[model samples]
Each structure stands twice: as C-alpha cells, then as structure tokens.
Target chain A: DVKVTQSSRYLVKRTGEKVFLECVQDMDHENMFWYRQDPGLGLRLIYFSYDVKMKEKGDIPEGYSVSREKKERFSLILESASTNQTSMYLCASSRVLGGNSPLHFGNGTRLTVT
Target chain B: AQTVTQSQPEMSVQEAETVTLSCTYDTSESDYYLFWYKQPPSRQMILVIRQEAYKQQNATENRFSVNFQKAAKSFSLKISDSQLGDAAMYFCAYRKGSGGGADGLTFGKGTHLIIQP
Candidate 1:
C-alpha cells in the first residue's frame, strides 16, 4: 500500500511565525498535493507539484508556498502564521491524473496558531 | 471554476441499514471525474468510490456505490448494510479529465455520517 507521511501530527505556532509542514510519499508518485481541511469548507487545495521543483497555486494559495526539490518529498511553507491559519493540513499523492490513479493521503497535521 | 455542493451537513443511520449522501456539482467542461472520499475521525482520508463521466454505469466498491447522473450533474453515494466503522466525513470531489493530474480536485463541503446503534 502507498503511504504518505507528514512530519508532524500536531503543531502549535505563534502569530507572525514561519511554519514548515513536511510530507514524503513512499510510492514515488508523480503528483503531490497540499490541502487545508476545515469544518465546513472541506479540503481546499493550497498547492500542488507535478514534478520536482515545479509547483502550482491552488484555489487558496495566499500566504502559502510550496517546495518540491525531491521526488519523494513536498513541503508547504506558511510565510507568516496567523490565527486564521489554524486548521488541519493534509498531504496526498497520486500516480497520475486519471481514474486509474487514486489519491492516497497522509494522516493530517493539525496546526494551531496562537 | 467548478463547484461542488453537499447539501446534507449531517446524516444518521442505524447499523446494517442503508444511507445515501447527496452531492451536486456545476461545471462547464464536458469531461471530468467524480469521487467520494471518506475521512474517519483523526485518520487519513481515503477514496471510497469513483466514477468517470463517460461511463454510463455507476461505480461500486464493496458495499459502497455511487449514483452518477451525468445530465443532472449529481453524484450521490449509497452505503448498504452500514457498519459502525462507516461513520466519517464524506467529501465529494471533481477533477477535469485532462491535466494529466496537474490540476487538483475541487471538493464540496463534506457530509458527516453518523452510525446509530
């Protein structure tokens, strides 16, 4: 089975702090995604990378950036954490984009900004 | 932009019974894919079922199935013989057929499923 690992399961940060959320997938999938899961809004995509060193902005990319210097690792960076940034962040990987390639998600990291 | 809607914020069903979660979407593209994902409490989210737009038949996985209506732009999930472990926050997602996986999925506000003993 494919496994996506997030470095932290729970995180606490103060306002104006820079935060880094790490994700690594064992299956070496080509597509990696970062999403923020909230109570009512569901999972909103933050950023995605299709290849190493390549990234694309999702619907909600403000105040967030991503780095994919390696095939197995993708990182999400919060430039300046704020109270509004407190939410569950999820990391997912897929072989490709299509019906045959289903997304496999890692246990999310719950971030609390104080 | 594509949008997905899950009207039922919460639903409860007895064990061994059946329950359906509703989802509707609006998109201008003709080809795309629909999916139902389950996120158990404090666990990783997983794909439960998926349906291709071109396929006329609905997709099913074990006891989980989807009612995909292409014309109406609705995709609902039906779980039969529900078990206690079936409780979760169910999300409906959409992705365009193209993009080779570059474009991320557009998800709806999830429906929380509760299993009653």
Candidate 2:
C-alpha cells in the first residue's frame, strides 16, 4: 500500500501571511501533485512535479508555487494567504506512465485564512 | 481538452440496496482513463474503481462496478449493498493515457452519496 502523509491536518493563517503545505510519500513515486478542492468545483490542480527540481503549472497556479527537492517530498507554498485561499488542499503521488497506477492521496489539510 | 461531468449532485440509497451514480465526459482522444474516487467525511480520497476507454468490458471491484458506454461517452458507478460507510462524496475523473508528460487529471463536481438505514 502507498502511504501519502501531509504535514498538517488543519491550519489557520492571517491575511497577507505566507503559508506552506508539505506532503511526503513512502512509495517513492515519480509524480507528485497539489490540488485545492472546493464545493461544487471539485479538485483543481495547482501544481505538479514530475522529478526532483522539475515543476509545472496546472490549470490553477496563480498565487501558489511548489517545491520538489527530493523524490519523496513535495511542498506547496502560498505566497500571500487570503480569505479566498481558505479551502481543503490535497496531495497525491503516482508512478510514471506505462504502468496502470492510480494516484494515492493523503488526508487533506483544511486551511482557513482569516 | 477533456471534461468530466456528474449530473447527480446527491443520491440516497437504503442499506443493502443498490444505487447508481451518473458520469459523462467529453474528449476527442480515443484512448484515455476514467476513475471514480470516494472521499469520506475524514477527507481521505480513495479510488473506487477505474475503466480504460479502449476496453469494451466494464470494470468491477467487489461491490463496486462501472457501466462504461464508449459510444455515449458515459461512465456510471453502481454500488450494491450500500452500507453506512458507503456514504461519501464521489468524484469522476478523466486523464489521457500516459506518455503526455505527467498529465494532470480533470475532475467533475462530485456527487454526495447518502446511505439510509
């Protein structure tokens, strides 16, 4: 079984403050992703990393960035937290293509920005 | 571009009964993958089942099964013997079969399932 762990299960930050969300996977998957889930909108990709030091912007990348310094770790950074940024954030990891592997997700971190 | 849609926002099923959730998608690609994910109140997303577009046979896992209609571009999930633990938010997702350089998944507005005792 693949295990994905998030650094924080819940977080609260003030407006204009910077915030960080961390994710780690034990399976050493090559692909890691950060997504924000909202009501009626579902999960929208914020950023993804294919390999160490390689990152790509997803559909919704504004005000957010990601870091992948190691194969097992991925981090999401919120440049400036705002009330609108309050939502549930999810992290997922999967093996590279050619294999029929689905993403394994961590218990999401619910962020609250005041 | 690919898009996934779940028409039903909420569904109710009695324990030990069966319920089906509808999902439709639009994409020009001939080969892709479809998935149904269940997120419980704990906020952990779990893969319920998956179906490959190229395969004509529907995919099934234990009490969960999928009705895949390629011609209609429809993929529906059927849950038999619904239990209290089956109550969750179900999401339908689509992704282009590998080789596209870490392609991201497109997801639909999830349907909330409720199990009535």
> TM-score per candidate, in order?
0.97, 0.97
Candidate 1: where are CA atoms >4 Å away?
A98-100, B99-102
lDDT per model, in order? 0.92, 0.92
Per-residue lDDT over A19-106 for candidate 1, one digit per residue giving the tens place of the 0 to 100 score: 9999999997988999999999998989899889998888789999999999999999999999999999999998975554678999
- Tens digit of lDDT per residue, candidate 1, span B35-113? 9999999679999999989999999999999999999999999999999999999999998877553564889999999
**TM-score per model (chain B):** 0.95, 0.96
Score candidate 1 by lDDT. Answer: 0.92
Measured by DockQ, the strongest candidate is: 1
The docking quality of candidate 2, as DockQ, is 0.62
Candidate 1, which CAPRI tier? medium
Clashing pairs in 2: none
Q: DockQ scores for all the models shown?
A: 0.64, 0.62
- Residue-wise lDDT of candidate 2 within B1-117, one digit each (tens)? 788999999999999999999999998888789999999999989999999888999999999999999999999999999999999999999887765654648899999999999
Q: TM-score of the A chain in candidate 1?
A: 0.97
